[model samples]
Target: MILIDADACPVKTEITEVAIRRNIQAIFVAGSYLRVADHPLIRFFAAGDAFDAADDAIAEVARPGTVTITADILLAQRVIEKGGAALDPRGREFTPASIGDVVATRDLMHELRPGLEGQTGGQGGGPKPYAKADRANFKNALDRVLTRIARG
Candidate 1:
């Protein structure tokens, strides 16, 4: 199963395309109803209006061997803890060996954001814009992960 944190996800179409081609199941968890392609392999779960509700829903369903897609570092950590592989939209896979440093860096950035904002007069840079290259990388990463799982 490929579990996706759908809110703000840029690669939904890419994921669904891959899932369809690979004959894999994909569940997209979101805070509200989102239009998804009508396909038997694709499922959508509405997690309701609550902070981290979608994340909680995903955590509950993801198990070992499942692939989770998310940009949230904390949610990725949780999935990794459950033995699931976590990949960001940019195709960066989070693993046990790297999650700690990623989490710490994220925390440090969060802590510094306020101070930086104050110093910079509320100007803050957001994540880089998604690009076609990112989509290609995500497709390749998903295919590689699925192939490895199938081999085992």
Candidate 2:
């Protein structure tokens, strides 16, 4: 199963296409209603407008056989703790060996965010614009991870 943190995700179209083609069960969780594909394997979940509500919803169902797509390191850590796999939208897979460092770095960045906010002078701030290459990378990574899980 593929659990997606749908809000602010850039590769939703690609994810939907790949899930349908692979006949995978993909549950898209968001803060509110989202128009999802009309298919048996494609599902949509509205987690409400509370903080981390969507992440909480996704984590609740995360398990050994599930793969969650999220960019939030904290949510990814929670999913990993539950023995599920987590992948960033940019195609980076969070693993047991790497999650620790990833979390620490994320925390450090958060701590430094206040100081760095105005220092950039409107340059080098926030995530880069999603590109075609990023979409392709995400599709490839999703396929590879799903194939690995299927094999197991």
Candidate 3:
């Protein structure tokens, strides 16, 4: 199963296209974003109105090798530690070995965010143009996840 953390998610359309091409199931899970479409292959779940509830739900039900598309490093850590694949749409891969330091830096930055209220560094390195190269990379990553799950 391909699980998406849909709150502030980029690449939904890209993921949908890939899922269609691969003939697999893709579920977009959200907490309160109620504007998602209703599609046969692409399922949408509104877990709750609370923050991060969708993340918790996805983490709870995800098996040993599910693919979770999320930008949150914290959630990625949980899923990856459970033997799953956590992918950022921008192509960052999270794992147990690196999650600790990453999370610490992320949290520290969050704590010190108030100091950068006027810093013009505005959220760089987001999902790029979903180019052919990105599609190829994403396809390979999805294939790796599927292969690992199949082996288990």
Candidate 4:
């Protein structure tokens, strides 16, 4: 199963395509309804309008054999601790070995946000624009991880 944190997800189409090709169950979870492809292997789950609702829903279902796609570092940490694989939309996989450092860095940046905001007029630079290469990398990473899960 592939669980997607889909509110701001940029690779929904790519994920659906891969899910279809691989005959895998891919569930897109969001805070509200989002049109999804009409396929048996693909599903849409509306987690309602609560803070972190979608993330909580995804975490509840995460375990071994499940690959969760998310960019939220905290969510990734939760998934990993539950024995599920977590991959960022940019194709970076979060493992137990690396999540601690990743969480620390994220926390540091968060703690620095107030000071940085004062310096930059309260505007922080978000992620870079998603590119063709990112899409390709995500596809490859998803495939590789799925294959490994299937083999085991």
Best by TM-score: 4
Candidate 4 positional error at 5, Å: 0.2
Model 4: per-residue Cα lDDT at residue 63: 98
TM-scores, one per candidate = 0.93, 0.92, 0.75, 0.94
TM-score of 3: 0.75
lDDT on C-alpha atoms for all candidate structures: 0.91, 0.91, 0.76, 0.93
What C-alpha lDDT, on a 0 to 100 scale, does residue 88 get in candidate 4?
Answer: 97
Task: Give the alpha carbon lDDT tens digit for every residue of 98-144 in model 2.
Answer: 99999998776766665555652233278888888998889999999
- 30-149 per-residue lDDT for model 3 (tens digits): 986545445677888888988779989888867665789888888888787777778877656676788889899887766655434665434445335657677567667766666676
lDDT of 4 by residue, 1-152 (tens): 99999998999999999999999999999999999999999999999999999999999999999999999999999999899999999999999999999999887787676555356224458889999999999999999999999999
Model 1 per-residue lDDT tens digits across residues 1-152: 99999989999999999999989999999999988889999999999999999999999977788999999999999998988889999999898999999999987777666555355223459888888998999999988888887886
Residue runs of model 3 more than 4 Å from their true location after superposition: 33-39, 115-140
Which of the two candidates, 1 or 4, achieves a greater TM-score against the reference? 4
Error of 1 at 26 (Å): 0.6
Candidate 4 lDDT trough over 10 residues, lowest sum: 114-123
Q: Is candidate 1 or candidate 4 better by lDDT?
A: 4
For candidate 1, which ten residues in a row score worst on lDDT?
Answer: 115-124
